[model samples]
Structure formats: C-alpha cells, structure tokens
Target: MTEKISIESNVMDERRTSGELEIKIFNQSDKTRTALKKLALWWGLSLISVLLPVVHFVLVPLFFFLGFFFAWKGFKSEGQVLDGKTTCPHCGNNIKVGKGELNWPVTEICQSCARVVRMEKKEA
Candidate 1:
C-alpha cells in the first residue's frame, strides 16, 4: 500500500522561507511585452524628471523619486523560466523542456535512448 500525501501540506507549506515560492509565468510572450512597457515608462519618466529640475527644486525631487521608483521596480523584479526538467520515458534519462519553445503532446528524439520520446505539459 502507498501513502497518499495531502496536497495542501506537501505543495504549500505555511512556514516556508521567502524566495521558495514557485514563480509561475502564464504566457511567455507577456514577458517581452511587459519588459517593453517598463522601458517606455522609464524613458518617459526620466525625460520628465530632467525637465522638472529646470522648473523648481521641489518638483525636481518629486519627479526624481518617481523616476527612481519605476526604475527600481522595472529592473529588480525576479523572473521565472518557463522551462522545466523531466525524465525521458524511453531511456529513463533526465531531459529539459521549455513551455514557450515546444508544443504540448509532441515527441522528440531523446539524446540518451536515441528513441522518440513524447512530452506533454501537465496542469497542476
């Protein structure tokens, strides 16, 4: 007989340390879009900040703070890789697959076994 583990306890522990949580990326394309948006926002804010300094000292600080805040958020946030590791079915060897690159329910030649191995993304 096999023991079944509780999903709540095994998957999500309350006392787990920070940075241990799984970073989930729903769509890989969204990552590129988000980066471009942040770039545009930072550029606009920087131009505004530069112009504000000529107007008044008080406004200069406010614009500078806002510009720095957006820059910090844009560059500092950690990103998750869409790729994951799995075991090859044919030769029992480990393989890495990327969600953005491969289509689900597809097969590929395994390096170890030299056999066609099927890969599918499973939902949790």
Candidate 2:
C-alpha cells in the first residue's frame, strides 16, 4: 500500500524538522516478487561468470551464494521510501529524500550545510 505520511528530521545539533513523504508498504506478494528478482539477478551474474578465464572459480560460487543470500534479504524487506520533501534544520534549505529501502531513522546529508540529517516516521 502507498500512503502520504509525516516524518521527522533531526540533526546532531538538536535541530528538528517535520515533513511529508510518500511511501510504499510491501505486502507478502511484493516481498516474494522482490526476492525472486534478486535471486534472478545474482544467479544470472553467476552464470555469466562461468565464461571468465581464471575468476570463474571464485566469481561463480560467490555470485551463486549471493543470489540466495540477497533473495533472503529481499524477502525480509517491509517497505520502501519512494520520495519526500524536507527542509534542512541546519541550513533551512529544502532537501529531497530519494528512493531507498525503508529503514527507520534514515540518515541523509544536507546539501546546503553538509550536516547529517536523521529522519524517521512520525509517531502517532
């Protein structure tokens, strides 16, 4: 499901800001699909590595194992941050939160002030 949500941003200097964001929460099927895609990508790389001369011995096994590992990781994902708009608490400049895996208390850098910004879902 997709929703417009409120988030809070903070800096180490005790600066805080609030912003609105759009996020997508993945369902079971979505997680399964993501897992499959990850598996396919890594496995494909493993297959291609077989054509390499000496590296095939290492790369093939590495990529093959990584496929299962990444698939398991993708299956555990809950949601993703699509995009968001926020203001830098330090420089008071607008910052755009780009697409990424949804992890609580996401940290970003302020382009204007070069300060680290921490973001999290606003508590109800």
Candidate 3:
C-alpha cells in the first residue's frame, strides 16, 4: 500500500522550502466555474468586437454587461479554492499548486517527477 500524506494549506505558501514548485490552479466549484466561464466568454466577445469596427460600439458594451453579470453570479455562487497540497506519487516529493488549476481534483504534470499525476484536496 502507498502511504498518503496530508498537506495543510495554512502552513504552506506559494513556495515551499523543501524544493517544491509553486503553481497556479483553479479552485472554484462547478457552478462558480461555469459562471466564470460566462464571464470569460463575455470578455472574448468584447475583444472580438473591437476588431470589427462596424459592431464595436454595440458589441463591446453588450459583452461588458454580460461579463459583469457573470461576475456577479460567480460571486454569489458557493465554493472556493481549497487549501491543501499533495505528494508526487512518482517521485515521492511534495508538490504545491495554485487553486486555479484545480477543479474537483484533476491531473497535472509534476515538476519533480516530470510525470502526470492526479492532484486532489487533502482534508485537514
């Protein structure tokens, strides 16, 4: 059986002293993520509108409004980035990742082991 270690978010920062790399990941819940995606879509459309001068005036404002709406929805939604860490199963080293890269626990590339590993939240 493989030993499992729990990493507490309270104790660790972006960088660890034990040769762990700092990474940024997403930590929002499904609803929040969906809302954020809406915001992103708004922004994308707004950007694209800028390229089309004929529709810039109308599309830009429209997209901005939609983006704000999504932002508000995401703000009201529950769930946030969980504070925790996981061990690199391949190299047996501690790995730190940002909350942005996580969503219901996902697989990520480990810097130390140079292998893909599933990163999950550790209950404190």
lDDT tens per residue, model 1, 1-124:
1121111111122221111112343354554555556666665665566665466455555555665665455344334335444455445666554433223333445578665555433335
Instruction: Order the candidate numbers by TM-score, best to worst.
Output: 2, 3, 1
Question: Highest lDDT: which candidate?
Answer: 2
The regions of model 1 sitting more than 4 angstroms off are 1-81, 98-102
RMSD of 1: 15.4
**Candidate 2 lDDT, 1-124, residue by residue in tens:** 7998998898866778999788899999999999999999999999999999999999999999999998998887778889898899888889999998777777778999998888878898
TM-score of each: 0.30, 0.89, 0.40
Task: Write down the TM-score for model 3.
Answer: 0.40
Candidate 3 per-residue lDDT over residues 11-78, each given as its tens digit:
22243222222333324565567677878989999998999968899999999998989777665543
Colliding residue pairs in candidate 2: none
Give candidate 3 regions above 4 Å deviation. Answer: 1-37, 40-78, 120-124
Give lDDT: candidate 3, residue 118: 56
Compare candidates 1 and 3 on lDDT and give the better one.
3
In order, what lDDT does every prediction score? 0.43, 0.88, 0.56
